[model samples]
Target chain A: MAVLEVRGLEVRYPRASAPALRGIDLSLDRERLVVVGANGSGKTTLVRTVLGLVRPSAGWVRFDGRDVRTISGETGVSTNLAEVYRLISLPVRDLVEIVARLKGGDPAELEARLREFELGEVLGRRLFELSTGEQKIVGDLFAVSFGPRLVLLDEPFDNVDFSRRRRFVRLIRELRADLLLNTHELELIAQLDGWRLALMFEGRFLGPFAAADLDRLYLTRGTRADALAVMETSLGTFSVTRDSGDRPVKSATSLNALVESLA
Target chain B: MNLWRPYTKAMLANGSLWFWAFAFMAFWLAVGAFVESSGVGPGRSAVVAYTTSWYAVIVLLSLSMLAVAIANSLTYGSSALAYAFRFSRLTPEGYFGSIVGGSAVMGAALSFVLLGATAGMFGGRFRLLLLPADPAGLLAVSLLGGVFFMALAVTMILLVINYLGLKSTNFTGFLPLVLSITLGNAQIYLALPSWFVYGSPFNDLASLLYQGYAGTPATVELGAASVALTWEYLVVGILVWTAVLGASSLVLLRQIRSRQLEEGRQI
Candidate 1:
């Protein structure tokens, strides 16, 4: 069963001229899905909407065949490694316990996980007192304790150190939940196998592109045909159809490309 | 998940609670000592005044809430961790119970400290002050009464500000402390209204200290204490206010949840 399904999702901030997200359709099972986009592409909004942190303007989000908004959509291990919960003034242990209770995970399990990350010694320390990297590690550990059925991480590698990034990614990948990880770094998802990748731009799902093009998309951004030609020439192309109106449409290369071909 | 343990742990871990608790105790002790050495605090007839002296303790309880608010701003205030905590099955009731209950418990402990220090300062003369009020009423008013007032007043004050959309951790956290001190100080210089004085727990606590013990209450110069409301009326006020204060905490939880969610943050 699909653990998370979002269709025709639209989100508009109050008094904003443009929507943060337009009509975005997505589905995920237990598999890890990577959502990549430039800043302000609605990656965070999509994750927030799925977690019910932000109410959507239109469309529905279903989790494990249940409505996401109505189902008390707990963010099981949903945390952003890069940001500060600046208001958290308690010790790390208390924070972890809070997350545990929220997402239905065992506090004991969280403690054990913290020890694994060498964060056990610092658990007694206040969150605000910790270094940024230490705080990031603690936040990630709290999420791990949450262990909800669907985990959404926004910018999961933000404040983490270089050495710990890979390990953090590996640990999340090991969790037994459907993961919708929004990250700017494509290399972070390179280690996973059979992972579905998608691009969100101005709140629209632009691709479920093969994971093969994950890193190269940035190098080939332009008009549709130009981008595709560069992608094909540099890597390779698969004849794929995209959803248009009621039926899939096979769009031919653009006029600029056709003229280049005749030349 | 042991429900009480979280509240207990949080209360225990907060130095702010202990700081305010001990600070009030020391300050009260010092004042009592100063008054005795300088020959001032209570007159021979001022025995009742000593028993009712809980202003600092009340402020401490209110300050404790501010401390928690500030602390929470770091975690729940940030929104992401709040999102995790909210859906993770952490009941709003439990969270609130821990924060407010912890502060109340700390206040109760300080009351004991105040009682001990004040009696000692009077060279055992102050000990007999409780002989007039019913023992049960004295104990109830001294211990749980302060706890109830502190919890209700502080929680309501913080929640009202919270409802006003104040999000800055420093602002939300410290404003209560300032308000507690300000409102408390206001009564000192100002001839506060009778009903306002009566409703003001800090002003009326000494009077209400005898919750159920019936007697011809002697009038003391509790200038700010509400004199308009008779003692009988004050008794009903305590119970009603205590219950409402507790109930308001739940409302606070809802307000926080809805308001924070509106901002795409979790409470």
Candidate 2:
């Protein structure tokens, strides 16, 4: 049975000419799914919509076959988005305790998990006082500490150090929950082998292929008159663009390089 | 999880809130008491009237400040209410109940402080005004009044966020204080009709506070002539307002759908 489902999801900001997400359809059961996209490509918006933070302009989201709005708190949905910590002035310990109590998890166990991550020193410090890397680490730990049925991580490795990033990869591999992670780092795909991959560009999704095939994927100038960039994947070729221009074809494997070439 | 414990601790830990809640008002109250004591004779009607008026203002100001605090806690970016609603087992009604209950407790505690300060400063000089005629009634009114203001503030904040799409605290933050001073206490300054005075929640709250403190009908100065509001009229007005505001707050809490709050737009 599918644990989470989103159908025809579309989100538009007030006064914005373009939609942030358009016709986004997804279904996740027990498999780990990774969405790779550039900044402003609707990855964060999708995560937030799934968490019920943003209302969809069209369609609906459901968890365990029920509408997301009908369910109360502690529905086993967790995310590592640092925006959740913005403007929160409480100490990390208080935050952990609050979350643990709210989710019906053991506080002592959460504290132990913090210590395991070498984050015991942050217990006394307020969330806003921590560095960006530290905040990401705390957010990541909180998302996984509780026994969540579904976990969503948006750019979890953005500001983290190399050693902590390696540790987080191990943590992701060890997680028992179904995962939906979005990132632009192509190198992470090889590490997370066997996971499903989707490429997001301009509010649409492409290529639900194996993460191992990321090395074979490359972006080049499109042959079609209206297409801006064309993604050649092992599954098929997909193109989504509004601009029509003649530019040098730049073959790139990573999202950053592809975005740079597009720019 | 016990929500009150953490909520109360957070409220108590706010230094600026304490300054506004107790220290700032207490300073003005002490000064008023000292000046009034030196000028007026003991057991004078003028003293009772002055004390009642000052007490009403203090109650209004303190509760308004509390309303703003409660509003911020519920709607600000990364607010506890938002986080709990998203991740915890907390329902809208549960969160609303905890906030109102917490505000009532704080309101009752503050009433004691105000009453204690008034009695200590004036009791030495005026033996007749040693204490309120009904101390328990004053406490009850304070608690109920706190709940009313909190409900009103929360409903208004949520309404603005939902309809106007405005989530900035700078825009809607001081709404309670502004409303309390102008509309909430309009009866004190303007000559309102008998029906208006009896129907308006703000007027009712002011009347209740005045009557509770002085143990008599509250006299509303309407230009040259004044109207005395009876206890029956004030009680009915407050209860009706409380019920209406409470229901409105619950409805608005369940309807809040602003995406800006989660995006960190509140300043």
DockQ top scorer:
2
In model 1, what is the error at residue B210, expressed in angstroms?
A: 6.1
Candidate 1, residues B60-109, lDDT tens digits: the string is: 34434534443343234434433534454544565555555654555455
Q: In model 1, what lDDT does residue B44 have?
A: 50
Stretches of model 2 off by over 4 angstroms after superposition: A85-89, A223-256, A259-263, B34-43, B77-83, B122-129, B167-171, B183-194, B220-228, B259-267
What's the i-RMS of each model?
4.4, 3.1
Cα RMSD, each candidate: 7.6, 4.8
Superposed on all Cα atoms, model 2 deviates from the true structure by an RMSD in Å of 4.8
- Residues A1-263, candidate 1: write the lDDT tens digits: 77778899999988988899888889887677888766677898887777666678899888767776455434443555333233235677776666565556678898887788777888888876788777767666665555556667777677788767878878876888777778766566567666777755456665676565444433222234433322122222222222211111111122123222322
Model 1 segments more than 4 A misplaced: A8-19, A55-60, A65-70, A73-77, A80-90, A94-98, A101-104, A215-263, B1-3, B32-43, B50-86, B122-139, B142-163, B167-204, B210-233, B255-267
Residue pairs clashing, model 2: none
Candidate 2 chain A: minimum summed lDDT over ten consecutive residues — where? A242-251
> Native contacts recovered, in order, as a fraction for each?
0.32, 0.44
lDDT of 1 at B257: 31
lDDT at residue A244 of model 2 (Cα atoms):
26
Model 2, first chain, TM-score of 0.85
